[model samples]
Target chain A: MQPAVSHGDRPRLPIQAILRQTQDLPVLPGAIMRVIQLTGNSDATSRAIADAIGMDQAVTAKVLRLANSSFYGLPRKVTSLQEAVILLGFRTVRLIAMVAGTFTWMTRPLKGYDLPPRQLMRHSMGLALGAQMIARIGQFDPEEAFVAGLLADIGKIAIDNCIDGKISLMMQLGIKGGMTFEDVERTVLGHTHSEIGAHMAENWNLPQEIVEGIRWHHNPLGSGNSWLAHAIHLADVLAMVTGYGLGGDGLQYQLCEESLEICRVSAEDFDGLVEQFVGAVLHGEALLEGMG
Target chain B: MDVRQWNLSFGSQSGGGLSSHQFSVGLAEIRVVNGPTLLECQGIGSCIAVIAYDAHACVSGVAHIILPKRLPSSSSDRPGTFMDTAVEYLLNELVKAGAVAERLKWAYAGGSDFVHLASGASLPALELGRRNSEAAKSELSRLGAEVVGNDTGGTTGRDVSFCTADGDVKVRTVHEGEKTICNLQ
Candidate 1:
């Protein structure tokens, strides 16, 4: 499907201008950014990581609340950042901070895509859990997969923001014409959200693995061929299948077959993984609601 | 508390109480409810929702069916998990809950693949949405059920609700506004 020029003479905005909007988008807080950095450093002590979170009062509050929340059911209250970090483990605390930092834009309703409030947040949570589950089964780094899954679709925000109000119309046209969302995105905007999201990640100075996961998530074979990307790809499909939070495109995105191999799972294993993913999403929902 | 008792005991005299109560039908689950209960299911992307109603008895049921058939190794005992068993399970439960099988009417929505490969072809596993729709039609016929309304196949998700009080099944799509796709009465 050569980018359908069928609409003829529709004024299209340049991709460069669209990419520029992502600069205004908020990146992860310094505290959480440091936590992410420390997680990858084997020699980083827990106290150093705790000190990083303690620097941000807001992150500290959220981490304590999550550690004390029913999801953890801690016997005693976590009064300080160090206690919260120790109680929840450095990796878990880091994830909490990331989720907190990203929650704002993710929960907002993107009118261009006709997505309801919290739809993308829910989808991201679902994908995060799905990626973690696959990581657990495949013996990979679950934390890396979790972060990758959570941010894989962050580019959609840029696309929706740049597209203005044409989301619903383009969505309708895609559905009516039987075009994949990527195809529709390319047809109307020249570049897909993956590229836009990758640009956003670059602007934020995110880790290379995270950037590749977001960029190649929809098409792992096309780019860096990162296993993390494959995990996010499979997770996204499973998220769509379970209908965790459907946006304008719904289940209209193609499922990448190589993901199964990337995750080292067969089709039957994929089915079991889906059931596990659903359970994790349900559990994650309670914590997310508590965060609200 | 049972859904019926919980609704009736707290129900408003103005007929507003029971309608406020909603029961969610999750993946591969089914529930039979009597009026004025509302049964809701969400995000039926590649899955299907089979809604059956007996208007006269105010007995309605919904099945959120996930797959076309239950694989032999599937450990789930829930009958509503597959198309082959969903309608029969729903019908049996409705009858046991006071609906007459002969009086039952069916309506369904969901079974869409909004995602497809760039080559305009679906991977074999990804084609389940169309296959699910086909299995649903065949299963409905096999059970001799009358299907009165249908909204299936597209590149979108549907949020579905079946009101037992009036047997009204409403479907809301992402781009399309909500509509009462079928009524069993």
Candidate 2:
């Protein structure tokens, strides 16, 4: 798609070209990738996944820390990756590994978005926890929702890397012109971060549902109202509401109202949901501290 | 300057260089203070920051309210989590801190609907911001507190700072930067 030349002087690159620069994109760490692959294999055993995660010492340390953190409320300390996998299940271990693998990358400052160190990570954690809770309520796969929520904004990092200094200018212009951030992104870059993020997810061979969740989080209706997309949408809003990471965008995205219907969350229970989400965020924060 | 730094500089300047101590009120949290203390709630989106102050008593309180009402199943002891409970909690804390109940002035910021739904979308759940703001005003009215200012109902998030000594409320948004919305005094 050709982006409108609103800023004629500024260079515009098509989303395809941007994605073609594979080196600029974040590489899913090898250990995490192996775990993800194993997660999809019905024959994969807990010991196999644990051995794969143990290959990365840093990731293993983080996983152990999180497993021992109060977020899990384990009765005893978890000292080994194998024990963690057996106790927390392969799915939860995979989730923890994903968080550990992406922690440093997500914590980097995104000057284009005006997000400082740890701010974006905090927001991702909040969204991950919120999406997990909402997924449980909706009877969806909570683990998948958590991963989608965690990686939803990764496109912003990719955009920041590709555009460098141009994105901040676009953000300012968007705010000044009273346009939504996504609209400004589309106008200037031919794609919003959601689209770029979806492309990246696809490149990383993430599940189709997660790719769609990241792609249409801002406008789930565009995804034919997929439940995962809607859950991520609501979780994104919930993350903002709880004041997780209001960067330059700061609630600039639109909420898809049908998300509630798709997520099977009733209006009467919304307050309770907020309360539950807040509690989950607090728990997630504890896990973050453990990662430190 | 960035909003956070700008808020700090503004606080110190406006409080006559009293070495203001800033306390952040997080989600579903409330903070009450006296002297040159500043209570702040940042990244407020679809959440309300309900501010109450008594100029005569020099006491101020800010609550980061998440919802309109408390749920029956919610066992959270944090009063600031809900609009109705937040008002009652803030008022009680203010009075306990030497602020006169009748002399209290109220103001609020935030409760923005960041989601833009289709025109006919029927999700009432997305209206948490509006409901929070309405419930705040209604609860404050029920308690006979005079609301002096309101900066709410938009599609953007806000960062709100309240000065206990001067009763000045400064609201910052990505679009508007930072500006004092009201002074209860």
Candidate 3:
């Protein structure tokens, strides 16, 4: 099962050139960007967050719909942006806005990777929910974990946009050549999606931790054993194992054994963790439905 | 067997006199069907799909197995949830469908150790795919069923489609398109 052409013999692009191509990719929506900024600010008020979200009618409608959706299981209807903010809280609302804002692009099919419409979004939501659950268990900030998981594969979008339709060909060659997906990406594209995603996060002004999480999700040890990176890695694997929105890469990514040790999760907990992770994804299906 | 535990959710049903139905066997689920019916396990990673088919009776059963073994404290009643329990339940259902135990042909797929810490990583916890494949083979042998075909122990996820009509099993992967792995007949 050797590749028709040797990987080393294939022409490769420079990382800078690849990044330059991604420059045409859309930036984060203004309202979503503002919400993210305010969410990170210590002195920011719920009113400020609500106003930031309200600035975008589409995002505001989505946030309110999600707040009232069965995903949160609110006792009563959420009538307005302010009311929804008060009920779902700032972080949750911010998450909803971010999800809604990214919904359009995230749901687009990536022919290069063979991802159909909404599949990537489903995977991202699953990863976010799984990461949030693991964060709760590990006593880390669940919100940060959720954000990191949601945007972890964003590099794929950029790469897919940059590489035209050659990604699938590269994937085939790599798999046939017994190379990992990331390895193939690095071989031909000059950098893996993780690295590209990290760069995108940096440009988006995401926190350094989240940037690192995206960078080292495939190799958490590369981040000096960061817990967030490990959590994201585990979440990504769990999403794939549960068969939520799998792409051409499928489950080819590596799961670090030391991630369990770093996150204080044990082998015995695998079944329960999977159950909870699936349950969370199921419960959050309404949120995805609202986006659709 | 609890009737409630028998999950027979159909994915698609074709219209016509001879209706062809497709049943999706999700995580920890087992489904048995007769001719003109297809049972599928999609996007399987780490989890194993243990299939038993009796070509004579045109009956097939699939168990979407997740774990190598069941825990004592585990409250799950789905036999297909664990490799240890899945084989027995799947075999019993096949027998009930008029499949002879000795005549049944077994095929399994989708135990992938794609995600590993490093090359030759030796953590038992991370070897779920290998453990699942081993468990499936051992359990099928214990039941005296003839093991026919398998596509397991790789870093790629697989989608397995089994046609009860002919006992043909097709496996599809991301890199490789769908191909028939075996035909019990």
Candidate 4:
């Protein structure tokens, strides 16, 4: 896609080129990647995944701590990594690892976006928890939706990096010009964080569903078979409204009515879910501190 | 100046980390601070933060308001959650804390229309920051509290701080650095 030719004389590059120009995008840790790969296999056992994760001493320690923390409230003292992994299940373990590995990137303050340190991470986890709840309401797999929501804004990091700390100017222009942050980026930079995030997700070799979730979260109607995407869209809107880890976007993005229809979410249901979602977000914060 | 330096001056005054004395005002919650303290309201998207200060009395408070008005059936005891009731609560609390009702000065922040589609676009279900701010202003006018200053409306979420000692209301956002919108002696 052609890059937006901002206000100045500087030549604008295409989105693909901008992605290539990014310096050292973070990657999943070897152990987490191995666990992700192993979990995808039907024959993979809990013991095998635990052994793979055990290779990373830091992650092993965090996962064990999280398992033992009151967040889980497991019946007994879980001594072994294998036992903790089994109790938490593969998806929860993977999320713990993902949160741990990406903690720094997720926690760093993004200029111009008005996100203080860990604000984006807080928002990401809030969205993840909200998405899980929405997915459960729809009887879908909450785990998959959780991961989708967690990484939906991964592109914002790259976009923030590419803009070279001039996001504040872009944000100011958007606010004065009556434009959404996504629209401002697309108009001046020729790409929104959503698309940039999708490229990063593809580079990381994440599942296609997750890739689409990141790409189309802002506009899920265009994405075919966007059940997961719709859940994320609602979760994001709800999170923003409730001020859960909110940042520069604030309440500026458009809420897609189609997403509500496709996802079958009612206003009444949304209200009820919000109360539970808030508690879940607070609980998730405790888990987040443990991950760090 | 950058936020860090501005924060540092406060840090030196108190001889502690900024986070130590900082308190967040949640939805509908009102926190009254009488000593040298930095009462904060973080990440206000469409919501409004109503800050009232009486410097002479050294009594100040912040209310994080989520909605524009309070419904008749609204049963939440925290009056600060609604614009209509927030000013009343602030006035009452200030008087109880030794602040003269006629001496109160108010400052507003964080009513942003970050999502309005266009200048003349049809209204969405909620105008959010705009409505909350308007309601607060109208109610404050009715109660006869002088609104000293405000940095309301824009697309960015603001982290606001009101220090009780000097009644300095500092507004910080990503688009704009830290600026003291309201400074009272």
Candidates in order, interface RMSD in Å: 6.3, 5.8, 6.1, 6.3
Model 1 stretches astray by more than 4 angstroms: A1-16, A19-24, A68-79, A268-270, B1-19, B22-26, B29-32, B72-81, B84-98, B115-123, B138-144, B164-166
TM-score of chain B of each: 0.84, 0.86, 0.84, 0.83
All candidates: TM-score: 0.83, 0.84, 0.81, 0.81
Q: Estimate the Cα RMSD of every predicted model relative to the unseen true structure.
A: 5.5, 4.9, 6.2, 4.9
Candidate 4: segments with Cα more than 4 A from true spot: A1-11, A14-17, A38-44, A68-70, A73-79, A112-114, A267-279, A290-292, B1-19, B24-30, B68-103, B116-124, B134-147
Instruction: Give me the displacement of residue A178 in model 3, in angstroms.
Output: 5.3
Task: Report the C-alpha lDDT of model 2 over A2-21, residue by residue, as the tens digit.
Answer: 12223323436777787775
Q: How many residue-pair clashes does candidate 3 contain?
A: 1
Which 10 consecutive positions of candidate 3 chain A have the poorest summed lDDT? Answer: A1-10
Compare candidates 1 and 2 on DockQ and give the better one: 2
Report, to 2 decimal places, the DockQ of model 4.
Answer: 0.31
> Each candidate: what lDDT?
0.75, 0.78, 0.77, 0.72
Q: Provide the lowest-lDDT 10-residue window in model 2 chain A.
A: A1-10
lDDT of 1 by residue, B28-138 (tens): 788888766778776787788999888888788899988788765666666776788888888889999999988999988888865555456545656667878899999
Residue A114, model 1: Cα distance from true site in angstroms: 1.7
TM-score of model 2's chain A: 0.88
Q: Which candidate is the best by lDDT?
A: 2
